[model samples]
Target chain A: MLKVLKYSFYDLSRSRWTYAYLLFFLLLTFGLLNFSHDLSKTIISLMNVVLILTPLIGTLFGALYYYNSKEFIDLLLALPLPRRSIFLGKYLGLSLSLSASFVIGILAPMLLFGILSTGLVLNLVILMSTGVLLTFIFTAIAFLVSIRFEHPIRGFGAAIFIWLFLAVIYDGILLLILIWFEHYPLDHFALLMTLFNPVDLSRVLIMLQLDISALMGYTGAVFRKFLGTSLGMSIAYATLLTWIIVPVFAFLWLARRKDF
Target chain B: MIVRDLYKSYRKHQVLKGVSLGLDPGRITAVLGPNGSGKTTLIKCMLGMVIGQQGEISANGKNIGHDYLYRKDIGYLPQIARFPENLKVRELVSMVKDLRNQPANYEELVSRFGLGPFMQKPLRNLSGGTRQKVNILLAFMFDSRYYILDEPTAGLDPLSLQRFKEMLLNEKQKGKAVLMTTHMVHLAEEMADEVVFLLEGKVYFHGGVQELKDTYDGMNLEAAIANILSLQEHA
Candidate 1:
């Protein structure tokens, strides 16, 4: 498994797309810092971009890599290795590389700005951790979709739709539900809905951490009431971790029984 | 190696129906069939690439479903030669070696296939024949008890084809079980001591080449196979 992971990582590290992704982060972080000149404000701006962009890239890159390497994977399946190792290795390799890019891309700019020496360091850590978690979650979902669909076009389309539904549509529907139930005490319903979507949960977590929950409207205020303490934060992080674990296990289950 | 009561289907279409055969060392058995007759599917099931719905395949006294380590005893050449385009030929070779953790002397196979010049080139840069040669080299590099070659003669020049035949003969001489599938009847005639003919996911015939010829009342191996298919059409 480690050997497979090593080769996958080596292969991805040399690809032009990895470098392009890294460069995009660098330019975005540097541009945001230069324009805002405020650490918290810059983090807020970065959060908005990270929430949407990371999942999009993760979904597309994951599916593309799986489809492109499929023949080679068939070759590997003939080798003296377990199917679980082959698949999990590729998933870990991709996740690590993407996480490395996110970390280095944002860290380099933050260090240059001396943000580490200020009270905003915790916020920076939360923001980066959220980005990493999103990468893992979306990439695993992509792998699950790719393994289930044999055709690249179908797999690609399904993955993109998942990202769209989670990142955008889920929020719109949640808004409608909130307005429709405006007559009742809906904090619990809003919290449960946020928990269902990682994107919304991440936004609430970050906003609460930045101590700007007052601007977050009704649901955000409710999230603050529930997640204002460290225990709530821990629960949110646990839920995010569940988001990563479920899809990955589902991918492995499907891959084990799949025919090449 | 033995495969017993093998059955496989893709959705509503059955590809292999109760294929049972025993493969022996020091012999080459050619699996022959028309398109969609399940030749490759049988080989894939044996290799455990495609799981059979109901069957048992055992290699060297161990059931394949028991563990994957048994795959080390079998070397396979796929029908298509596709690889990671970004990896150089040498790197790909070494990576396979690293994965299998087996000592392999690919140097001779490389030189025999005239792949010395392309060793440093990425796989995508090589021609189809060269890639096929590379595939041949990889399959032949490691010494194993069983060799499964699917369409092994595809895209090969006459000279390289000759070399491939010699390689198979050498393996047979060393007492290795070689199972191959091909449309090249002449190659099968020259190399296969026995042939298994498949039609509509069932074994239509399995015997020595001469036996197949005599049974079908044909002049040669190709005629015998054609006769069998034509007979099926009439029936």
Candidate 2:
């Protein structure tokens, strides 16, 4: 499994898109920091971008890699290795590489700007951790989508659809439900709903950490009130961890039963 | 190796239905069938790449169910030579060797197939015949007891094809069980000690080359298979 992970990481690290992704973050972080000259505001801006962009890139890259490496994967299947190791190795390799790019891209610019000396360092840590979590969550979901659908176009479409649903549509539907039930005591309901979507949970968690009530919105306020600061952060992280694990198990289950 | 009452289906389409056969060391068995006749499926089932719903497959008197270590004893050459395009031939070979953790002496096989010139070239840059040679080298590098080659002669030049046949015969002499699928009747007639003819997901005929020829009253193995198919169509 470690050998498989090493090779996969090596393979993905050399891909042009990985470098492009890293460069995009580097430019984004440097540009935002240079203009604003405020670490907190830059983190907020970066958080919004990270929450949306990470999932999109993760889903697209994961599905593309799975489909493209399919023939090679078939060859690997013929070898004397367990099926679970092959898939889990691939998942970890992809997640780690993407997380590395995100970490390096964001950290280089921030360190140059000396944000580490400020009180905002903890906030930056939360933001980076959330970014990494989003990458793993979406990549695992994309693996599940790719293995479930044999056709590349269908798999690609499904992955994008999932990202859109979680990153965009799910929030919209939750907002509609909140508006419809405005009269009821809905704080607990809202917090529970936020836990279901990793994107919303991450947004709320970071907003609470930043303690910016105006930007917290209703879901974030509910999260803060229901669980407080430290407890809310821990629970949100746990939810994100669950999000990563469930889809990975689903991917392995589907891969084991799938016909090569 | 023995297979008994193996059955497999994709959706509503059945590929293998109650197929059974045995493969022995020091002999080669050619799995012959028309298109979509479950030839590849059988090979995959034996390799445990595809799971058959109802069957028992045992290698050397041990059940293959829920076990993967037995695959180390089998060398498989897929029908298509698909590889990581970015990896050079040498790197891919070493990667597989590392994955299997087996000591392999591929230097002679590499030179025998004249693959030395293309060793540093990425797999995607090589021609089809060259890639097939790489596939053959990968399969033969490990000194395994069993081999499953699917369309091993595809895209090979006459010289390489001759070399490939000699290599298989050499392996046979060293007591390896080889199960291959091919459309080349001449290769089968020249090499196979037994023939398993599949039609509609079942074994329609299983015996030696001359026995198949005598039973069908045909001049050669090719004519015999053709006659069997035509007779089935007419019947």
The regions of model 1 sitting more than 4 angstroms off are none
Cα lDDT tens digits, model 1, B1-235, are: 9999899999999999999988899999999999999998999898888999998999998889836898899889999888888889999999999998998999999988899999999998999999999999889899999999999999999999999899899999999999999999989999999999889999889999989888867689998888878988999
| DockQ, Cα level, model 1 | 0.83
**Candidate 2 segments whose C-alpha is farther than 4 A from its true place:** A217-221
Candidate 2, residues B152-213, lDDT tens digits: the string is 99999999988999999999999999999999998999999999999999999999999999
How do the residues A1-260 of candidate 2 rate in per-residue lDDT, one tens digit apiece? Answer: 89889989999999998899999999999999999999889999999999999999999999998998887688789999889989998889999999999999999999999997899998999899999999999999999999999899999999999999999999899889988999998878888888899998888777777888556567556666765657766777888999999999999998888788
TM-score (all chains, Cα) for each model? 0.98, 0.98
lDDT of each: 0.91, 0.91
CA displacement after TM-score superposition, residue A238 of candidate 1 (Å): 1.4
If you assessed candidate 1 against the hidden native complex, which CAPRI class would it receive? Answer: high
Docking class of predicted structure 2: high
